[model samples]
Target: MRFYQATRFLFPGSLRLRMLALCSVGTHIPLLALAGWQLATGRADWPSLGLVIGATLVGTLFTLLCIDALLAPVRIATRAVAALEREQTAALTAVRDGDLLAELVVGVNRATEATKVRIATLDDAAHRDPLTGLLNRRGFLTRTEAARDGTVALIDLDRFKAVNDQFGHDAGDAILQDFAAYLARGVRRSDCVARWGGEEFAVFFPETEEGEAAGILHRIVRRMGAGLIDRPDGSPVTCSGGVVALDGETIGQAMTRADAALYAAKRAGRNQLRVSDAHIRLD
Candidate 1:
Protein backbone atom coordinates (compact mmCIF):
# COMPACT_ATOMS: atom_id res chain seq x y z
CA MET A 1 0.00 0.00 0.00
CA ARG A 2 2.82 2.41 0.87
CA PHE A 3 4.62 1.63 -2.41
CA TYR A 4 1.46 2.33 -4.38
CA GLN A 5 1.03 5.76 -2.74
CA ALA A 6 4.68 6.63 -3.41
CA THR A 7 4.17 5.77 -7.10
CA ARG A 8 1.03 7.94 -7.23
CA PHE A 9 3.30 11.01 -7.00
CA LEU A 10 4.60 10.22 -10.53
CA PHE A 11 1.07 10.68 -11.96
CA PRO A 12 -1.40 13.56 -11.79
CA GLY A 13 -3.97 13.20 -9.04
CA SER A 14 -6.84 12.79 -11.52
CA LEU A 15 -4.91 10.16 -13.47
CA ARG A 16 -4.10 8.29 -10.30
CA LEU A 17 -7.78 7.92 -9.53
CA ARG A 18 -8.54 6.62 -13.06
CA MET A 19 -5.63 4.17 -12.86
CA LEU A 20 -6.87 2.75 -9.56
CA ALA A 21 -10.36 2.26 -11.07
CA LEU A 22 -8.88 0.43 -14.03
CA CYS A 23 -6.92 -1.77 -11.67
CA SER A 24 -10.22 -2.82 -10.05
CA VAL A 25 -11.63 -3.93 -13.44
CA GLY A 26 -8.43 -5.75 -14.33
CA THR A 27 -8.58 -7.64 -11.07
CA HIS A 28 -12.22 -8.63 -11.67
CA ILE A 29 -11.69 -9.93 -15.22
CA PRO A 30 -9.25 -12.60 -14.12
CA LEU A 31 -11.53 -13.90 -11.38
CA LEU A 32 -14.56 -13.95 -13.74
CA ALA A 33 -12.61 -16.00 -16.24
CA LEU A 34 -11.72 -18.59 -13.58
CA ALA A 35 -15.37 -18.81 -12.46
CA GLY A 36 -16.53 -19.33 -16.07
CA TRP A 37 -14.07 -22.21 -16.51
CA GLN A 38 -15.33 -23.92 -13.32
CA LEU A 39 -18.99 -23.74 -14.51
CA ALA A 40 -18.04 -25.05 -17.97
CA THR A 41 -16.35 -28.11 -16.41
CA GLY A 42 -19.65 -28.90 -14.55
CA ARG A 43 -17.91 -28.46 -11.24
CA ALA A 44 -19.79 -25.26 -10.23
CA ASP A 45 -23.41 -23.96 -10.11
CA TRP A 46 -25.13 -20.52 -10.27
CA PRO A 47 -24.42 -20.38 -6.53
CA SER A 48 -20.70 -20.42 -7.44
CA LEU A 49 -21.19 -17.42 -9.73
CA GLY A 50 -22.92 -15.57 -6.89
CA LEU A 51 -19.97 -16.35 -4.59
CA VAL A 52 -17.54 -15.05 -7.23
CA ILE A 53 -19.44 -11.72 -7.53
CA GLY A 54 -19.52 -11.29 -3.75
CA ALA A 55 -15.80 -12.02 -3.39
CA THR A 56 -14.91 -9.60 -6.18
CA LEU A 57 -17.02 -6.84 -4.63
CA VAL A 58 -15.46 -7.40 -1.19
CA GLY A 59 -11.89 -7.48 -2.60
CA THR A 60 -12.45 -4.33 -4.64
CA LEU A 61 -13.79 -2.53 -1.57
CA PHE A 62 -10.72 -3.63 0.44
CA THR A 63 -8.31 -2.46 -2.26
CA LEU A 64 -10.09 0.88 -2.60
CA LEU A 65 -9.94 1.35 1.18
CA CYS A 66 -6.19 0.72 1.21
CA ILE A 67 -5.68 3.17 -1.65
CA ASP A 68 -7.62 5.85 0.24
CA ALA A 69 -5.52 5.24 3.37
CA LEU A 70 -2.33 5.66 1.35
CA LEU A 71 -3.70 8.88 -0.14
CA ALA A 72 -3.91 10.49 3.29
CA PRO A 73 -0.18 11.20 3.12
CA VAL A 74 -0.45 12.84 -0.30
CA ARG A 75 -3.24 15.12 0.92
CA ILE A 76 -1.18 16.07 3.96
CA ALA A 77 1.82 16.82 1.74
CA THR A 78 -0.13 19.12 -0.58
CA ARG A 79 -1.54 21.10 2.32
CA ALA A 80 1.84 21.39 4.04
CA VAL A 81 3.46 22.76 0.84
CA ALA A 82 0.69 25.34 0.52
CA ALA A 83 1.22 26.47 4.10
CA LEU A 84 4.98 26.74 3.56
CA GLU A 85 4.46 28.94 0.51
CA ARG A 86 2.25 31.29 2.48
CA GLU A 87 3.88 31.39 5.96
CA GLN A 88 7.60 30.71 5.28
CA THR A 89 7.93 28.77 8.54
CA ALA A 90 5.37 26.02 8.10
CA ALA A 91 6.27 22.44 9.04
CA LEU A 92 4.75 19.04 8.54
CA THR A 93 2.66 18.05 11.54
CA ALA A 94 0.73 15.10 10.10
CA VAL A 95 3.50 12.53 9.67
CA ARG A 96 2.56 8.83 9.77
CA ASP A 97 4.74 5.79 10.36
CA GLY A 98 6.32 4.29 7.17
CA ASP A 99 5.39 7.29 4.96
CA LEU A 100 8.18 8.51 2.64
CA LEU A 101 6.18 11.62 1.71
CA ALA A 102 6.07 12.63 5.37
CA GLU A 103 9.86 12.32 5.60
CA LEU A 104 10.36 14.59 2.58
CA VAL A 105 8.19 17.29 4.13
CA VAL A 106 10.18 17.19 7.39
CA GLY A 107 13.47 17.64 5.51
CA VAL A 108 12.15 20.64 3.63
CA ASN A 109 11.07 22.27 6.87
CA ARG A 110 14.56 21.85 8.34
CA ALA A 111 16.19 23.50 5.31
CA THR A 112 13.83 26.46 5.55
CA GLU A 113 14.70 27.05 9.20
CA ALA A 114 18.43 27.00 8.47
CA THR A 115 18.06 29.47 5.58
CA LYS A 116 16.19 31.96 7.74
CA VAL A 117 18.90 31.93 10.42
CA ARG A 118 21.71 32.40 7.89
CA ILE A 119 20.00 35.40 6.27
CA ALA A 120 19.57 37.13 9.62
CA THR A 121 23.26 36.60 10.47
CA LEU A 122 24.43 38.11 7.16
CA ASP A 123 22.16 41.13 7.59
CA ASP A 124 23.62 41.87 11.03
CA ALA A 125 27.18 41.64 9.66
CA ALA A 126 26.55 44.23 6.93
CA HIS A 127 25.15 47.52 8.32
CA ARG A 128 26.56 47.58 11.84
CA ASP A 129 29.92 49.24 12.49
CA PRO A 130 32.22 46.68 14.13
CA LEU A 131 33.03 49.22 16.86
CA THR A 132 30.05 51.57 16.96
CA GLY A 133 27.45 52.85 14.52
CA LEU A 134 29.02 56.17 15.52
CA LEU A 135 30.95 55.06 12.37
CA ASN A 136 33.71 52.48 12.79
CA ARG A 137 37.35 53.50 12.97
CA ARG A 138 38.06 51.31 9.88
CA GLY A 139 35.37 52.96 7.79
CA PHE A 140 36.96 56.36 8.43
CA LEU A 141 40.42 55.02 7.65
CA THR A 142 39.42 53.57 4.28
CA ARG A 143 37.65 56.72 3.10
CA THR A 144 40.53 59.03 4.08
CA GLU A 145 43.10 56.77 2.43
CA ALA A 146 41.18 56.83 -0.86
CA ALA A 147 41.13 60.66 -1.06
CA ARG A 148 43.07 62.31 -3.90
CA ASP A 149 46.58 63.55 -2.97
CA GLY A 150 46.09 66.55 -0.72
CA THR A 151 46.66 68.07 2.70
CA VAL A 152 45.34 66.26 5.73
CA ALA A 153 44.50 67.86 9.08
CA LEU A 154 43.74 66.71 12.60
CA ILE A 155 41.74 68.94 15.01
CA ASP A 156 41.29 68.73 18.79
CA LEU A 157 38.72 70.73 20.72
CA ASP A 158 40.33 72.48 23.72
CA ARG A 159 39.11 72.37 27.34
CA PHE A 160 36.66 69.54 26.53
CA LYS A 161 37.14 68.14 30.04
CA ALA A 162 35.45 71.16 31.64
CA VAL A 163 32.10 70.02 30.26
CA ASN A 164 32.52 66.49 31.62
CA ASP A 165 33.83 67.82 34.94
CA GLN A 166 31.29 70.58 35.58
CA PHE A 167 28.09 69.48 33.81
CA GLY A 168 28.46 65.66 33.93
CA HIS A 169 28.62 63.05 31.11
CA ASP A 170 25.24 64.03 29.63
CA ALA A 171 26.47 67.51 28.81
CA GLY A 172 29.69 66.08 27.35
CA ASP A 173 27.59 63.85 25.03
CA ALA A 174 25.49 66.81 23.86
CA ILE A 175 28.62 68.83 23.17
CA LEU A 176 30.13 66.00 21.15
CA GLN A 177 27.00 65.60 19.05
CA ASP A 178 26.86 69.34 18.40
CA PHE A 179 30.57 69.48 17.50
CA ALA A 180 30.34 66.45 15.20
CA ALA A 181 27.63 68.12 13.16
CA TYR A 182 29.56 71.40 13.04
CA LEU A 183 32.70 69.62 11.81
CA ALA A 184 30.77 67.67 9.19
CA ARG A 185 29.55 70.90 7.59
CA GLY A 186 32.87 72.76 7.99
CA VAL A 187 34.64 70.75 5.27
CA ARG A 188 33.98 70.46 1.54
CA ARG A 189 32.48 67.36 -0.07
CA SER A 190 35.80 66.80 -1.82
CA ASP A 191 37.35 66.48 1.64
CA CYS A 192 36.95 63.68 4.19
CA VAL A 193 36.33 64.22 7.90
CA ALA A 194 35.88 61.81 10.81
CA ARG A 195 35.70 61.77 14.59
CA TRP A 196 39.02 60.19 15.53
CA GLY A 197 38.16 59.74 19.18
CA GLY A 198 36.99 61.72 22.20
CA GLU A 199 37.45 65.45 21.48
CA GLU A 200 39.62 64.78 18.40
CA PHE A 201 38.54 65.08 14.74
CA ALA A 202 40.50 64.46 11.53
CA VAL A 203 40.10 66.00 8.07
CA PHE A 204 41.51 65.17 4.65
CA PHE A 205 41.90 67.42 1.61
CA PRO A 206 41.93 66.00 -1.90
CA GLU A 207 44.51 67.29 -4.41
CA THR A 208 45.76 69.77 -1.77
CA GLU A 209 49.08 70.43 0.01
CA GLU A 210 50.00 71.23 3.60
CA GLY A 211 49.81 74.98 2.96
CA GLU A 212 46.27 74.73 1.65
CA ALA A 213 45.16 72.43 4.50
CA ALA A 214 46.74 74.85 7.01
CA GLY A 215 44.92 77.86 5.54
CA ILE A 216 41.56 76.08 5.74
CA LEU A 217 42.24 74.96 9.30
CA HIS A 218 43.22 78.53 10.35
CA ARG A 219 39.97 79.94 8.95
CA ILE A 220 37.96 77.28 10.75
CA VAL A 221 39.74 77.99 14.04
CA ARG A 222 39.01 81.73 13.88
CA ARG A 223 35.36 81.12 12.96
CA MET A 224 34.86 78.62 15.78
CA GLY A 225 36.84 80.75 18.26
CA ALA A 226 34.65 83.77 17.48
CA GLY A 227 31.69 82.14 19.24
CA LEU A 228 30.44 80.04 16.30
CA ILE A 229 28.79 77.57 18.68
CA ASP A 230 25.73 79.18 20.30
CA ARG A 231 25.43 78.81 24.07
CA PRO A 232 23.32 80.42 26.77
CA ASP A 233 26.05 82.75 28.04
CA GLY A 234 27.85 82.99 24.62
CA SER A 235 31.20 81.65 25.92
CA PRO A 236 33.46 81.00 22.93
CA VAL A 237 34.58 77.53 21.78
CA THR A 238 38.19 77.16 20.60
CA CYS A 239 40.04 74.37 18.71
CA SER A 240 43.67 73.58 17.77
CA GLY A 241 44.73 71.61 14.70
CA GLY A 242 47.73 70.33 12.72
CA VAL A 243 47.95 70.02 8.94
CA VAL A 244 50.38 67.90 6.87
CA ALA A 245 50.93 66.65 3.31
CA LEU A 246 50.54 63.05 1.96
CA ASP A 247 54.13 63.04 0.65
CA GLY A 248 55.65 61.35 3.71
CA GLU A 249 56.41 57.81 4.96
CA THR A 250 52.88 56.39 5.14
CA ILE A 251 49.38 57.63 5.91
CA GLY A 252 49.60 56.36 9.48
CA GLN A 253 53.06 57.84 9.99
CA ALA A 254 51.96 61.13 8.47
CA MET A 255 49.07 61.21 10.93
CA THR A 256 51.51 60.63 13.80
CA ARG A 257 53.67 63.55 12.70
CA ALA A 258 50.56 65.68 12.33
CA ASP A 259 49.65 64.87 15.93
CA ALA A 260 53.00 66.21 17.13
CA ALA A 261 52.36 69.46 15.28
CA LEU A 262 48.83 69.60 16.72
CA TYR A 263 50.33 69.37 20.21
CA ALA A 264 52.60 72.27 19.28
CA ALA A 265 49.56 74.30 18.14
CA LYS A 266 47.70 73.66 21.37
CA ARG A 267 50.76 74.66 23.43
CA ALA A 268 51.21 77.93 21.52
CA GLY A 269 47.53 79.03 21.62
CA ARG A 270 44.06 77.64 22.24
CA ASN A 271 42.97 78.34 18.63
CA GLN A 272 45.59 77.83 15.94
CA LEU A 273 46.61 75.68 12.92
CA ARG A 274 50.19 74.45 12.50
CA VAL A 275 51.59 72.72 9.42
CA SER A 276 54.12 69.95 9.88
CA ASP A 277 57.50 69.99 8.03
CA ALA A 278 57.53 67.71 4.98
CA HIS A 279 59.51 64.47 5.38
CA ILE A 280 60.86 62.70 2.27
CA ARG A 281 60.56 58.89 2.20
CA LEU A 282 63.42 56.79 0.71
CA ASP A 283 61.20 53.82 -0.22
Candidate 2:
Protein backbone atom coordinates (compact mmCIF):
# COMPACT_ATOMS: atom_id res chain seq x y z
CA MET A 1 0.00 0.00 0.00
CA ARG A 2 2.84 2.38 0.84
CA PHE A 3 4.58 1.55 -2.44
CA TYR A 4 1.34 2.17 -4.33
CA GLN A 5 0.89 5.50 -2.58
CA ALA A 6 4.49 6.53 -3.20
CA THR A 7 4.23 5.82 -6.94
CA ARG A 8 0.64 7.05 -7.41
CA PHE A 9 1.83 9.74 -9.80
CA LEU A 10 3.01 7.06 -12.20
CA PHE A 11 -0.52 5.59 -12.36
CA PRO A 12 -2.51 7.99 -14.52
CA GLY A 13 -6.25 7.45 -14.37
CA SER A 14 -9.36 8.43 -12.46
CA LEU A 15 -9.41 7.70 -8.69
CA ARG A 16 -12.06 5.03 -9.15
CA LEU A 17 -9.97 3.10 -11.70
CA ARG A 18 -6.92 3.19 -9.47
CA MET A 19 -8.87 1.93 -6.46
CA LEU A 20 -10.42 -0.88 -8.51
CA ALA A 21 -7.02 -2.03 -9.79
CA LEU A 22 -5.58 -2.22 -6.27
CA CYS A 23 -8.54 -4.14 -4.91
CA SER A 24 -8.50 -6.68 -7.78
CA VAL A 25 -4.76 -7.34 -7.36
CA GLY A 26 -5.02 -7.77 -3.57
CA THR A 27 -8.00 -10.12 -3.48
CA HIS A 28 -7.83 -12.16 -6.69
CA ILE A 29 -4.10 -13.13 -6.63
CA PRO A 30 -4.32 -15.06 -3.30
CA LEU A 31 -7.54 -16.82 -4.26
CA LEU A 32 -6.07 -17.97 -7.59
CA ALA A 33 -2.90 -19.22 -5.85
CA LEU A 34 -4.99 -21.23 -3.37
CA ALA A 35 -6.99 -22.78 -6.23
CA GLY A 36 -3.76 -23.80 -8.03
CA TRP A 37 -2.44 -25.45 -4.83
CA GLN A 38 -5.69 -27.43 -4.43
CA LEU A 39 -5.48 -28.71 -7.96
CA ALA A 40 -1.82 -29.73 -7.55
CA THR A 41 -2.74 -31.67 -4.39
CA GLY A 42 -5.64 -33.46 -6.25
CA ARG A 43 -8.18 -31.95 -3.88
CA ALA A 44 -10.05 -30.15 -6.72
CA ASP A 45 -10.83 -31.24 -10.33
CA TRP A 46 -9.99 -29.04 -13.39
CA PRO A 47 -13.73 -28.47 -14.01
CA SER A 48 -14.19 -27.27 -10.38
CA LEU A 49 -11.13 -25.01 -10.81
CA GLY A 50 -12.75 -23.51 -13.90
CA LEU A 51 -15.99 -22.90 -11.95
CA VAL A 52 -14.18 -21.23 -9.05
CA ILE A 53 -12.17 -18.97 -11.39
CA GLY A 54 -15.30 -17.97 -13.31
CA ALA A 55 -17.28 -17.26 -10.09
CA THR A 56 -14.43 -15.15 -8.69
CA LEU A 57 -14.21 -13.00 -11.84
CA VAL A 58 -17.98 -12.46 -11.95
CA GLY A 59 -18.25 -11.63 -8.23
CA THR A 60 -15.33 -9.16 -8.26
CA LEU A 61 -16.61 -7.33 -11.31
CA PHE A 62 -20.14 -6.91 -9.85
CA THR A 63 -18.83 -5.76 -6.43
CA LEU A 64 -16.46 -3.25 -8.00
CA LEU A 65 -19.25 -1.84 -10.21
CA CYS A 66 -21.42 -1.23 -7.12
CA ILE A 67 -18.52 0.52 -5.40
CA ASP A 68 -18.02 2.81 -8.39
CA ALA A 69 -21.70 3.69 -8.31
CA LEU A 70 -21.51 4.50 -4.60
CA LEU A 71 -18.56 6.84 -5.20
CA ALA A 72 -20.46 9.02 -7.66
CA PRO A 73 -21.98 11.21 -4.95
CA VAL A 74 -18.57 11.73 -3.30
CA ARG A 75 -17.17 12.81 -6.65
CA ILE A 76 -20.00 15.29 -7.05
CA ALA A 77 -19.33 16.73 -3.60
CA THR A 78 -15.61 17.06 -4.36
CA ARG A 79 -16.24 18.95 -7.58
CA ALA A 80 -18.73 21.26 -5.89
CA VAL A 81 -16.24 22.10 -3.14
CA ALA A 82 -13.52 22.81 -5.70
CA ALA A 83 -15.84 25.11 -7.64
CA LEU A 84 -16.60 27.05 -4.45
CA GLU A 85 -12.86 27.54 -3.91
CA ARG A 86 -12.38 28.81 -7.45
CA GLU A 87 -15.42 31.10 -7.49
CA GLN A 88 -16.85 32.85 -4.45
CA THR A 89 -20.40 32.72 -5.78
CA ALA A 90 -20.40 29.07 -6.77
CA ALA A 91 -22.97 26.63 -5.23
CA LEU A 92 -24.25 23.07 -5.47
CA THR A 93 -27.45 21.99 -7.15
CA ALA A 94 -30.26 20.62 -4.97
CA VAL A 95 -30.44 16.90 -4.24
CA ARG A 96 -33.78 15.18 -3.59
CA ASP A 97 -34.39 12.46 -0.98
CA GLY A 98 -31.33 10.23 -0.80
CA ASP A 99 -29.12 8.13 1.55
CA LEU A 100 -26.45 9.44 3.95
CA LEU A 101 -24.26 10.67 1.10
CA ALA A 102 -27.12 12.64 -0.38
CA GLU A 103 -27.72 14.28 2.98
CA LEU A 104 -24.05 15.20 3.03
CA VAL A 105 -24.37 16.89 -0.35
CA VAL A 106 -27.32 18.96 0.84
CA GLY A 107 -25.42 19.96 3.97
CA VAL A 108 -22.45 21.06 1.92
CA ASN A 109 -24.65 23.12 -0.36
CA ARG A 110 -26.19 24.92 2.61
CA ALA A 111 -22.75 25.54 4.08
CA THR A 112 -21.49 26.93 0.80
CA GLU A 113 -24.37 29.36 0.59
CA ALA A 114 -23.77 30.57 4.13
CA THR A 115 -20.07 31.09 3.48
CA LYS A 116 -20.86 32.96 0.28
CA VAL A 117 -23.02 35.48 2.11
CA ARG A 118 -20.47 36.03 4.87
CA ILE A 119 -17.70 36.58 2.37
CA ALA A 120 -19.75 39.03 0.37
CA THR A 121 -20.57 41.05 3.46
CA LEU A 122 -16.97 41.10 4.63
CA ASP A 123 -15.64 42.11 1.23
CA ASP A 124 -18.05 45.02 1.00
CA ALA A 125 -17.16 46.21 4.47
CA ALA A 126 -13.46 45.97 3.73
CA HIS A 127 -13.51 47.89 0.47
CA ARG A 128 -16.54 50.18 0.40
CA ASP A 129 -17.52 53.54 1.89
CA PRO A 130 -20.63 53.09 4.02
CA LEU A 131 -22.24 56.45 3.30
CA THR A 132 -21.33 57.03 -0.35
CA GLY A 133 -21.04 53.42 -1.63
CA LEU A 134 -17.84 54.25 -3.46
CA LEU A 135 -14.62 52.29 -3.23
CA ASN A 136 -12.42 53.41 -0.32
CA ARG A 137 -8.72 54.24 -0.53
CA ARG A 138 -7.58 50.73 0.39
CA GLY A 139 -9.82 49.24 -2.31
CA PHE A 140 -8.50 51.61 -4.94
CA LEU A 141 -4.91 50.69 -4.16
CA THR A 142 -5.62 46.98 -4.05
CA ARG A 143 -7.49 46.89 -7.34
CA THR A 144 -5.01 49.01 -9.30
CA GLU A 145 -1.72 47.67 -8.00
CA ALA A 146 -0.70 46.28 -11.39
CA ALA A 147 -1.88 49.26 -13.45
CA ARG A 148 0.54 50.75 -16.02
CA ASP A 149 0.65 53.77 -18.34
CA GLY A 150 -2.43 55.39 -16.83
CA THR A 151 -3.20 58.83 -15.40
CA VAL A 152 -4.09 59.51 -11.73
CA ALA A 153 -5.73 62.59 -10.29
CA LEU A 154 -6.36 64.00 -6.84
CA ILE A 155 -9.50 66.13 -6.65
CA ASP A 156 -10.86 68.49 -4.01
CA LEU A 157 -14.19 70.22 -3.81
CA ASP A 158 -13.71 73.97 -3.62
CA ARG A 159 -15.35 75.52 -0.54
CA PHE A 160 -16.40 72.19 0.90
CA LYS A 161 -15.94 73.50 4.42
CA ALA A 162 -18.05 76.54 3.71
CA VAL A 163 -20.86 74.27 2.54
CA ASN A 164 -20.61 72.19 5.70
CA ASP A 165 -20.61 75.24 7.97
CA GLN A 166 -23.55 76.97 6.30
CA PHE A 167 -25.83 74.03 5.55
CA GLY A 168 -25.21 71.85 8.63
CA HIS A 169 -23.67 68.38 8.59
CA ASP A 170 -26.76 66.64 7.19
CA ALA A 171 -26.81 68.86 4.14
CA GLY A 172 -23.06 68.41 3.86
CA ASP A 173 -23.62 64.66 3.82
CA ALA A 174 -26.16 65.11 1.04
CA ILE A 175 -23.65 67.01 -1.06
CA LEU A 176 -21.08 64.27 -0.56
CA GLN A 177 -23.53 61.61 -1.59
CA ASP A 178 -24.54 63.62 -4.63
CA PHE A 179 -20.92 64.13 -5.56
CA ALA A 180 -20.17 60.42 -5.24
CA ALA A 181 -23.09 59.51 -7.46
CA TYR A 182 -22.01 62.06 -10.04
CA LEU A 183 -18.49 60.67 -10.16
CA ALA A 184 -19.78 57.15 -10.54
CA ARG A 185 -22.02 58.10 -13.43
CA GLY A 186 -19.62 60.45 -15.19
CA VAL A 187 -16.57 58.21 -15.54
CA ARG A 188 -16.19 55.52 -18.17
CA ARG A 189 -16.73 51.92 -17.10
CA SER A 190 -12.98 51.24 -17.29
CA ASP A 191 -12.04 54.13 -14.98
CA CYS A 192 -11.87 53.72 -11.20
CA VAL A 193 -12.85 56.42 -8.72
CA ALA A 194 -12.39 56.31 -4.97
CA ARG A 195 -13.28 58.42 -1.98
CA TRP A 196 -9.74 59.02 -0.82
CA GLY A 197 -10.80 60.75 2.42
CA GLY A 198 -13.05 63.61 3.57
CA GLU A 199 -13.81 65.89 0.61
CA GLU A 200 -10.86 64.51 -1.39
CA PHE A 201 -11.22 61.83 -4.09
CA ALA A 202 -9.00 59.89 -6.47
CA VAL A 203 -9.53 58.90 -10.08
CA PHE A 204 -7.60 56.62 -12.42
CA PHE A 205 -7.88 56.61 -16.19
CA PRO A 206 -6.12 53.42 -17.20
CA GLU A 207 -4.27 53.21 -20.51
CA THR A 208 -5.02 56.92 -20.98
CA GLU A 209 -2.68 59.60 -22.26
CA GLU A 210 -2.23 62.81 -20.24
CA GLY A 211 -4.07 64.88 -22.83
CA GLU A 212 -6.97 62.45 -22.94
CA ALA A 213 -7.15 62.27 -19.16
CA ALA A 214 -7.24 66.08 -18.99
CA GLY A 215 -10.23 66.17 -21.32
CA ILE A 216 -12.13 63.46 -19.43
CA LEU A 217 -11.57 65.12 -16.04
CA HIS A 218 -12.68 68.46 -17.32
CA ARG A 219 -15.84 67.01 -18.72
CA ILE A 220 -16.66 65.20 -15.51
CA VAL A 221 -16.12 68.36 -13.46
CA ARG A 222 -18.14 70.48 -15.82
CA ARG A 223 -21.11 68.18 -15.45
CA MET A 224 -20.64 67.92 -11.69
CA GLY A 225 -20.75 71.72 -11.37
CA ALA A 226 -24.34 71.91 -12.54
CA GLY A 227 -25.76 68.74 -10.97
CA LEU A 228 -24.67 68.70 -7.31
CA ILE A 229 -26.79 69.49 -4.25
CA ASP A 230 -28.01 73.08 -4.56
CA ARG A 231 -26.50 76.09 -2.81
CA PRO A 232 -28.86 78.97 -1.92
CA ASP A 233 -26.95 81.27 -4.29
CA GLY A 234 -27.36 78.66 -7.08
CA SER A 235 -23.71 79.10 -8.10
CA PRO A 236 -22.57 75.81 -9.60
CA VAL A 237 -20.60 73.52 -7.26
CA THR A 238 -17.02 73.43 -8.56
CA CYS A 239 -13.89 71.35 -7.92
CA SER A 240 -10.12 71.72 -8.30
CA GLY A 241 -8.10 68.77 -9.60
CA GLY A 242 -4.50 67.79 -10.40
CA VAL A 243 -3.72 65.02 -12.89
CA VAL A 244 -0.41 63.27 -13.64
CA ALA A 245 0.59 60.55 -16.07
CA LEU A 246 1.75 57.44 -14.19
CA ASP A 247 4.76 57.18 -16.53
CA GLY A 248 7.40 55.30 -14.51
CA GLU A 249 6.66 56.81 -11.12
CA THR A 250 5.09 54.89 -8.23
CA ILE A 251 1.53 55.89 -7.44
CA GLY A 252 2.71 57.44 -4.18
CA GLN A 253 5.16 59.76 -5.98
CA ALA A 254 2.58 60.62 -8.62
CA MET A 255 0.06 61.39 -5.89
CA THR A 256 2.56 63.69 -4.20
CA ARG A 257 3.02 65.65 -7.41
CA ALA A 258 -0.70 65.63 -8.00
CA ASP A 259 -1.29 66.97 -4.46
CA ALA A 260 1.13 69.78 -5.12
CA ALA A 261 -0.64 70.58 -8.35
CA LEU A 262 -4.01 70.44 -6.52
CA TYR A 263 -2.87 73.09 -4.07
CA ALA A 264 -1.59 75.02 -7.06
CA ALA A 265 -5.09 74.92 -8.56
CA LYS A 266 -6.58 76.01 -5.24
CA ARG A 267 -4.12 78.92 -5.14
CA ALA A 268 -4.46 80.06 -8.74
CA GLY A 269 -8.27 79.90 -8.82
CA ARG A 270 -10.72 77.47 -7.23
CA ASN A 271 -12.18 75.63 -10.20
CA GLN A 272 -9.61 74.24 -12.65
CA LEU A 273 -7.25 71.33 -13.52
CA ARG A 274 -3.44 71.32 -13.17
CA VAL A 275 -0.78 68.95 -14.46
CA SER A 276 2.24 67.29 -12.82
CA ASP A 277 5.10 69.72 -13.65
CA ALA A 278 3.87 72.08 -10.87
CA HIS A 279 4.73 74.78 -13.43
CA ILE A 280 2.70 73.41 -16.36
CA ARG A 281 -0.82 74.80 -16.93
CA LEU A 282 -3.81 72.80 -18.23
CA ASP A 283 -6.16 75.60 -19.26
Task: Estimate the TM-score for candidate 2.
Answer: 0.64
Q: Which window of 10 residues has the lowest lDDT sum in candidate 2? A: 94-103
lDDT of 1: 0.67
Give the per-residue lDDT of model 1 (tens digit) for 1-283.
5765555554333534555666678778977788888878977777767888888878887887787788787777756654555545544555443444445565567657766877876655553243323333454566665554677777888888886787687766766677667776777767766667788877778788677667766777888888886433357667888888877455666688878878887777657777765321101
RMSD vs true structure, all candidates: 9.7, 8.5
Q: lDDT for every model?
A: 0.67, 0.76
Clashing pairs in 1: 150-208
lDDT tens digits by residue: candidate 2, 28-102: 896779787887897977787787778777877887899888888786876675455554444344332333344
Model 1: residue 20 alpha-carbon error in angstroms: 14
The best candidate by TM-score is 2
| Inter-residue clash pairs, candidate 2 | none
